[model samples]
Target: MIFQLGCSHGLPGIFACLEGAAAIHFQDFNAEVLQCLTIPNVNSNVPSFQRPALQVTKCDAGMEIHFFAGDWREIHKLLPYAQNIDVSTGKGLDAQYDIILMAETVYSISAVAHLYELIKMCITPSHGVVYMAAKKHYFGVSGGTRRFLSIVEKDGVLASSMVAEVGDGSSNVREDQTLSLFFLFLFFNLLPCGCGHQFGHLPLIWRIKYCNRN
Candidate 1:
């Protein structure tokens, strides 16, 4: 199962999941917005124009598209009724999803800790993966991402294992004159909190691996 968080506009990630025929759990902060997506529409079309077009094209095709709309802070409410099972057993109805994909959702510092907690709760101990993508500018805004990182590190949930080294001997280079050529170093470490932080200057993607020994 795949969970798509903050799926606005349903771009690359959504389309990719569709291509793979994966079972998707789409989420957003607005119920009205999610309703609008049910009516298949392309990015180029105006909102009003796309709704009718989608109704005519795909609504009758029996496509079982799932959508969740609500504030990210209230994800429990946003989840489908069937998906929310007995909390007493410590697992939701859809426990242990194979992957969780978050896009453009980490820019809010206030939401980072909660997001990490949710991810940890939803994934199983064995083979789950969480992928997140965010722009460098987001981290610079009040250092929200950095602060979250610090909190995770302070809690001993993650260790800053490595930092990328770039410049003179780096292998990444671009031929475009307009683009500055820079070397990128990658970091591989365990995030004790189940979430890792990456910055704009960092060329490497940091990862958190579950440590079963402890």
Candidate 2:
């Protein structure tokens, strides 16, 4: 089974995992967002593939996709299914997952720290993969992407080849203006690190995967 954390709008990453016939768990902090996800099943842009059965809610379930409606600290309390679990205040999600994902959630330094900690908790001795994406720039803002890169590098996580690239442009209306380009980052666990930290970066698509070592 595969799980997507902080799934918003059901992106292709989550859908692709489903295509592989993996039972999918979709989670989000907002019940309304989870409720809105059901819309795509009824009117999907991708018509060829059947949508995966998605369970959405505000609390953690013993299912593959667990959505916590509050801080990661609170969600950790209810995480189940994975072993070697440890709980800590200000810690992130606590269960090992197959294919964990996040998108457009790391725009601030605090968020980056939280994300890193969350990823650490989800990783087990078995090799796992984490995929993250963030905008290159935002409304003439810079450094967020660089900061994220630095944080990941300092933590010694290996990043795979860039996955997706977006073009740069601007909109006529201020509200619609383009601020940043999106870049994807992939991390494969080669060793175990007992510690994690956070930093700052623009929002992008992020995904994490948990698998059996054997």
Candidate 3:
């Protein structure tokens, strides 16, 4: 199972569908975004013979696709695989996602806490992983990967590793230098003239996993 939070066009969820994920759930803030954009994008990309105008429970490849729209704090109630707690047993439903993917989600400091809370509720216990791509710092805004990781550290339930860091010659390189040589080679090859500075923020990808927290 996979869940994509704040899924605008649901590109990641659609890709998961193509990759034969058992289930993919997409959530966004607006119902209209899901109705108009996300569902259509899935139909187009997920290889259905006839594109249904309405959302269906299963696709041709037997992949289950679901969509939810609401605030992060409340969206878990609507997700099918959410980690709902059993009142009598004090145990989770164990229907959480195996993988979670989001890009540029932590752009607002105000929403960071809520987003993190939702992630905790939806990711599978002890083994689920999350892949997030975001800037190290947002210029006018306050939230970033660093800020999000700080919250994760304080919570002490999850451990994070930097998968890749994208620099544009504007930021200082640290001694640890998590950026790989292959990535650097590809970066320079794509730009050719070392013109990565044209883009603004210093993007970084992160891998997060459960740290024995239930």
Candidate 4:
């Protein structure tokens, strides 16, 4: 299970699907981008794309690949597994994502909080992790990995470790970072809150729940 936020070309998310993530959801601000670049690229790579409907062939336990377009602050409603979480406790009702991937998402300082909030809302409770790639900082925009980490540090909710750093003469993190888990599983109980914060819930524990039969 994985999510690609602010997916531009969606290579990382597509790769995750190839890497065996059963479900991969791609989100972008502009619907056109998803329709144009992202969807085409995905079709070229995976052969087909799927919505929430489950479809798997007998010979293959297929993957659920979904694409969404909208502002980060509001797209949760359209996402599955999102309406099944208890935001107060940080656990999910259905299943949260095992991993969340993002690149160049943190370039906007203003959207960082909403982005983190969305992550907390959708990610698995215990073992789920996030991998983000962005320049150390965006030149015009003051948003960067360092700036986003400050929010994580201040919250004191999730522990973080730098996975890699790219020193291309740019004072930015070239690699990615993973956010530590701090909660437990909560997929048994679900309270559907429509039009509310609907970040998908999956306490992956790194659990790989696919859409097809094994």
Candidate 5:
């Protein structure tokens, strides 16, 4: 399972599909971008075969391909199989994604909170992880991984570990540390909704905290 947030050209999401992710959801801020650039790119790139177009639906049967164009805050409701994660309680959703990938999306300080919350909503609970790549700072934007992580810290819902940093004295993009990954675990409620799903035997369960609330 994979969620490609802010999938501009949809390259990363398409790559996931080519890599045979059971399901891949591509999201961006504009629908036109998807239709003009992303979809065409996908149509051209998917492994060409004599067969017809593959059917992608909500189930895990075939390679599920979904597209969404909108702000992160409102898009999750329309996202297939999006678990209703309660950020406050650190609980919700019967299932979660195996991997979440994003690149160069942390440039907006105002949107980082919504982006991180959405990640929590879409990611699988215990073993799920997010891999992000961005510069140490986005010049003139006053936004970067450092600013975004501060939001995560204040929320006390997720954890982060630095993955890599690259810098050479002479390069114009000096100290533009490459990427980071947040491997998070939380004990939150997984409630049953009208979808005929049922909760655990207990109406509520206190999940084991994932090591940090500091």
Candidate 6:
């Protein structure tokens, strides 16, 4: 299962869908964004004939597509897999995501902690991995890759590695970093985020994973 948090246009989630992920969930802060942009973008890429009814949870391929919109603090209540987690400990009861992807989602310091907590609830406790693409710093907001990593490092459950970095003469450097596992090429192709950094197509990438998976 794959989950893309704070998905604006949901490009990464769409890529996972095209890759034949058994399930892909796209989330955003606004329902309108999902209706006007995310859904349309997905449908444009996935043929109409191939799409199962949105109400249908699963199909022959074990494929499921879901979209959600709400604040990070409370949205987990509505997420199917998140319902399986023990919220107090941020561990799973029955269901959790194998892969979680987010881009430019760490720009607000106030929201970063909530986002991290939500990740803990949704990801598989033992071996789930996360792919995060963001700038090293967000300047005025004081939220960025390093800020988010500080929280992760303090927790000591997940470990991160720099997968790819982009300079391109830009003062603010951005990186595609991960927690653990897998080799895959990410073709981002000039997607610009709110922080003013544009990610170009990247090469083979490594990710971050749980440190004490047993």
Top-lDDT candidate index: 6
Q: Which pairs, if any, clash in model 6? A: 178-208, 179-207, 179-208, 179-209, 180-207, 180-208, 180-209
Q: What overall lDDT goes with each candidate model?
A: 0.43, 0.42, 0.67, 0.60, 0.58, 0.71
Model 3 misplaced stretches (Cα beyond 4 Å): 49-56, 86-93, 171-202
Instruction: Please provide the root mean square deviation of candidate 1 (C-alpha atoms, Å).
Output: 10.7
TM-scores for all candidates? 0.55, 0.56, 0.77, 0.73, 0.72, 0.82
**Cα lDDT, model 5, residue 124:** 69
Write the residue-wise lDDT of candidate 5 on 25-63 in tens digits: 778888877676656666665554112222244433367
Total colliding residue pairs, candidate 4: 11
What is the Å distance of residue 99 in model 2 from its true position? Answer: 1.5
Candidate 6, 1-214: lDDT as tens digits: 9988887777777667766888888889988887767776676664331442333345455678888889998988888878776756675565579999887888899999999888887888766888888877788999988888899889886777787775667467776785232223333633322233334534323355676763
- Stretches off by above 4 angstroms in model 5 are 48-61, 90-92, 168-214
Task: Give the lowest summed-lDDT range of ten residues in model 2.
Answer: 171-180
Q: Residue pairs in steric clash, candidate 1?
A: 157-192, 157-193, 158-192, 164-185, 186-204
TM-score of 4: 0.73
- Model 1 lDDT tens row, 67-170: 66666556755454324555554334555566565544656777777666565556544665555443323535442334445654665533322222222344
Q: Model 1: runs farther than 4 Å from truth?
A: 37-64, 80-94, 136-144, 151-209
Evaluated at residue 24, the lDDT of candidate 1 is 54
**Which candidate tops TM-score?**
6
lDDT of 3 by residue, 131-189 (tens): 77677767688878878889989988778878776666667321111234432332223
Pick out the ten consecutive residues of candidate 5 with the lowest summed lDDT. Answer: 199-208
* TM-score (C-alpha, index-matched) for candidate 1: 0.55
